[model samples]
Target: MKRKINSFSRKITNNPNLPAAHAMLYATGMRESDFCKAQIGIVSNWYEGNPCNMHLDILGKKIKLSVINQKNLIGFQFTTIGVSDGITMGTPGMRFSLPSRELIADSIETVVEAHHYDGVIAIPGCDKNMPGVMISLLRLNRPSIIVYGGSISSGFYNEKKLDIVSSFEALGEKNTCKISEEEYKNIIKNSCPGPGSCGGMYTANTMASALEAMGMSLPYSSSSPSTSENKKKECKIVSTFIQKLLERKVKPKDIVTKTSIENGVKLAMCLGGSTNLILHFLAIAKSANVHFTLKDFQKISNQVPLIGNLKPSGIFLMEDIHKIGGTPVIIKYLLNQGILSGDCLTVTGETLHENMKKIPNINFNQKIIYPLNNPIKKNGHIRILYGNLSPEGSVAKITGKEGIFFRGEANVFDSEEDANKAILNHKIQTGEVIVIRYVGPIGGPGMPEMLKPTSYIMGSGLGKNVALITDGRFSGGSHGFVVGHITPEAQSGGLIAFVRNGDFIKIDAENNLLTLEVEEEEIQKRKKEWIPPLLKVKKGYLYKYIKTVSPASEGCVTDQF
Candidate 1:
């Protein structure tokens, strides 16, 4: 093969004075001629710690082998850390989850930069891993590609499909005596039968689809199941594309432009994606130096229709959508409606329009992805709201079924644990808005997901009756009239800390408002007496995170804080 591209490897390989560098390469089994080839770093977030990433070691090896087969390229595989959000949620362990995103991104960046690899192939399987890897790629500004580890195949129980959320919700059912203890055990046992991210339109699947829409991953990459033969087939094709990317000097920043970011947001809106996207996208935008904001998200949310009939808010699972077709089918629908920008460039070294030209039109016969004209919801379910409560902003995922407007009295708790206990104990009532405070980035010191508490609300049959507002966030599987990512969090001395029980709170998704019905003078008095609580962690990563992490509005990115 003829070489036509410059490589970062040349910095180390071509320097005769760097005998140690050459020695290291030789020690790793590199041949004389191999030194001249482009060095590609295949970064893997593989660990046996969770099902989401358990099989990634096998996938990473396959990717390395594929890269080895590509002439004029030498593949070097490296590992990064990945925290399992599902395993950590609701525990003190959960504080490490959001901070893990930074760790993953920083670790990958450190390895790739230190090694001087010319390009990268990031394989991220979980929520933070996807954005974490993407952020590093954008920061590195190298020829790169992403291959999602893919969604898990849904587990079956009692002739019904189940995923991780099913297990979580089962805990609530057991507490409420909605199901027998044996039945709850059965759901837990079968909820996750094998490897892959959670099989819903949760954060993992949502980020994957959003990345694909933004032209990072290949079409259908987001929707493939982890154990599928198709996923392996897709892995084999990435090495060839990475070579093309390197040859053309196509970097992530070139592909992840403002229009492309908007494309991603538009797709997320239609998919009814996790509220986490707002946090992740803001971080990605900062890394890419794109001028995107939550306001930008609200702009797209206003126009895009919620067409995907999948997941926590809908009747189908990701596997169901995969059966009909994958993310491409959904993209095809959006493209037809002119909601997506076709002119954007993708990792395939072709314009999105060019790529979509090859994708078959949306299969209207499928129920998993609805047509735009007859969407599940007419407007996007991601509502970005601003009011006295969230002076900066807050995010609310409201499927119309939850009702567009909710007005209730305050039910305040300083931590998710307290609120969760209250819900399980049946202390939370109808016509109440549960305010979970001091759990934001600075307060929780890691901004844990409120999945446990939210799932309890649903299991306790109060999903629609009582709304939960928080400074933390919700899992993609979490539904109900819940609002989170409240800015100026309690730790930051936001009015949320001053919220008292019996205070009136109103959430209006239709108008995009989050209002705390307290007089300004009274709120001022409360603020004067309020003292921020001590952080849960005082040392290690959580301590550093609390000191440096930005607010939720800025994606809680630590670098710029």
Candidate 2:
């Protein structure tokens, strides 16, 4: 049946009126409502001869028919067909089995080549999807625009409005005790109104924000809601921008320079952005053949202060950011301070300095973005530390922290699962360093964020006092004194492999040190018996991921040297 549908689709593609220039490669992880609303035509293209239907499934039940035809389909053969895949997490019963980053990158390459695509607009949200799409665009090196599915409208809970991440944390806490299932469902529904971006400063939203700050997206593109009329307008604008980009022969490399990446890093720090940005930015810089390291982040952090009052750091949403002039304002601030590369070009066909001039009367009032003089926190960059525990250096965010930057006994958990179990059992004590190993690149394989444990630590009200040290990365929304991305991971016999339970660990962000208070002889003795954990994926993408995924310090990106 699928073969039949493919045959029919091929026939349609062969029609000469369906010009290749009009062909827009709209790639997305989910079937967004904005995509459905921006469509023009639809037909029952035979999918495996099973008569698979295609239409807007907004309520997940009724299909809103925009176009229908039975006979004489030959006359309307020139009509465009919008491809919407149900690959996002929001889809019912859909597990997070989307293709790997490299696979998706290759797929986009194939799409651009096979379709002879003149222009492309990517609709990507969520952590993995954004980077996957961005990496693909970078490889394609074509005239492309990323249309982010924006954040959902704020949801109300307990008579107070709450964002997605906070809502989830609240739900997880509420579930621990007694709560009506119906109420939980209501909160879930309220939290997610429609097709949109992820709730927190998780990798998905943070990457979008970084892309915007880096001048890869149109103005206000990062925060527009997926269901808003403005979002539809932005899609049209992106389509138009793609045409312009093609006409001007603007490639991805034109916008993604080293300076542009520096701009992105500065913005990420100011917003107290996701730790995932560290990995994604590193991967992006690698694709561009630009040399960037974790140490560079530490250097940049010393100059840039955390100004954006967003979650995990402060109380604000992306919408508020949009209202306060967005990246343009932030860039202007950095440029004024002689911190940003003013010559960097943006998607708007203007240099970073030139774009700032376009915005009129930008305000830096305390309610919106705080000024550098009165920053929410100073030094927003993720710090890199090295010692006996992480000989090759580990990453940590020290922005907004208010306690002593000192050492504590390591309560090591070999994996996040063990750490979480201990947290749930209340075995974790305050001021003790929580060491989460085996969750690094080769450990979790993809290095899934150790957010669950971090949240549990926060929810237990010990977040202010305790410190989290892990080989894995944290979400952009994650704050506090959390150390991540211990390089030469335990799986590869890095220094983290020598750590034992109750070992004294020291983290001095001020001095850039993350050392285990153990003698060199004792560490050498443990290294002899320290066996690296073996990954057993024999087939599929996970196998490729395990083989190619770099360490957290290297951005955890796959297939790149």
Candidate 3:
């Protein structure tokens, strides 16, 4: 039964004074009984420039051939770097899409700590390759798993259901002529009909159903699909559960705690998901060192309730919740309504209450996941707002289908291509509140993601009589009455940089408030004639990510300010 060699692959493979690291891992071939096996570092954030990580190099060669057919394991595969925030959403290459989630977690923690790999599988498809490979498997507290390269099937057209946010709302329904140009070129050629990721519940199926309800992938590996055979047999059952998680050395900080990051924010606030899941779950609860904040997502969005109707804010997708019984039947309906925390742990080393006692029951006559006593929103739609234009707080996806009181009238625009060219040139109006403001994260040093100005304010029907505030961030195919991670961010000065154009903004989202109604001596005389705006990339890696990022209320993270 011989299975015990991994102490970082026994100090770089069967020592004997590491003969030049076993002739450089046999010059990329390896054998000598693969130095008595245990290596394992698959990684794969593959490319082809995007169909959300074009079939993740065929699920990284079927999870490196099921982690080298199990027993004592060996696998190596590598590759990282993915950025298509749906192909650089309103370009400058969408400021390298949130700095390619810190360059895919510093190129997978510098190739699993310079090739000492003794556990890590990751795979990941788009939208910051699932929290940049779960923050490089919580900063290499290894024996990791995460398979999720699924989701992509839904494209049709005449039969309707197309995706890639239906070609970013068909370029705002072809610049407001409301479709034609052969129906915006057949909704961008039947809206992404191949590979996967971005088939709603966006932000790559909302960080793959919040890392499979924070056990970090497995259990209907976040609702399958990328041309399913159950997402290639859940990548060979997460490569035979990463050899029982490296023979029980179960890591990733023993399955990401703080109650599984509040069971991944209570399954991304019961699947209404994305305000970029409050900036990729606060950069994966600060790389799972976990002291999570942004008010621990409004205290688990005041007790999770939205209940997955899906899409840019409902009407089903992640392949109709993988035909109504996936995501382990919505984590066994949020663990029989005690709203998740089924004893956490997972990578199939069980407990999420022993994987919800072999999941199954949620058919409740299918309407695509509702049944928490008739919910679509009785609570969590991811709000976290705070007043005085976000005094260190903000993030609103709001899903009570938008009307939680918005007061409007600001219209400003420091850029998301000038508020997507003033909402596709109709000059954004209807009780206005647009205000894109110096694109946060050290002011657009790389914040970028306003999903084409909130899909041109919902293809110009102005989604619910207009509203959009931002310090930059959105595109879980963005929905309206929007708001995004604002903080002391108009390049750190906050008060949304003393907002100005007709100032009157008062979003209350049922009293989580974001008010800006001016007059603290006219906001200190427009913050004494505000000025700070110049360094738009004075050099690379976004001028060292605008000299160290943070402040999207502290999760626009670049090593925490």
- Candidate 1's TM-score: 0.99
TM-score of 2: 0.80
Instruction: For residues 432-542, write the lDDT of model 3, one tens digit per residue.
Output: 888887887777868888788787778777898988888888888889888887887787788887788988889988879889887799888888898887868788788
Residue pair clashes in candidate 3:
439-444
lDDT of 1 at 394: 98
Look at candidate 1 and tell me the lDDT of residue 402: 94
lDDT of 2 by residue, 1-561 (tens): 111212222333445575542243223221222221212111111122110112112211111111111111111101111211222122211111222445555666666555444444565545555666677677767666666656656677778556555644554465454346676666666764444554445556678778887878786667665566655666544444544565466778899988888888887777777776777787888877789988788788788887766776567777666666655566677778787887987776777778777665558654767777888766665677887677777887776554539577888888777887887788988778888877667766556565567666665666788898887666555666788888888778878777887888888888788888888899889988777777734566666777777777777666666
Query: For each candidate, how many residue pairs have backbone atoms clashing (under 3 Å)?
Result: 0, 6, 1
Tens digits of per-residue lDDT, candidate 1, 264-299, equal 989988988999999999999999999999999999
lDDT against the true structure, each candidate = 0.90, 0.62, 0.82
TM-score of each: 0.99, 0.80, 0.37
User: After superposition, which runs of candidate 1 have C-alpha atoms over 4 Å from their true positions?
Assistant: 1-6
lDDT of 1 at 232: 96
Candidate 1 or 3, higher TM-score? 1
After superposing all C-alphas onto the true structure, candidate 2 shows an RMSD in angstroms of 8.5
- Deviation from native of the Cα of residue 477 in model 2, angstroms: 3.2
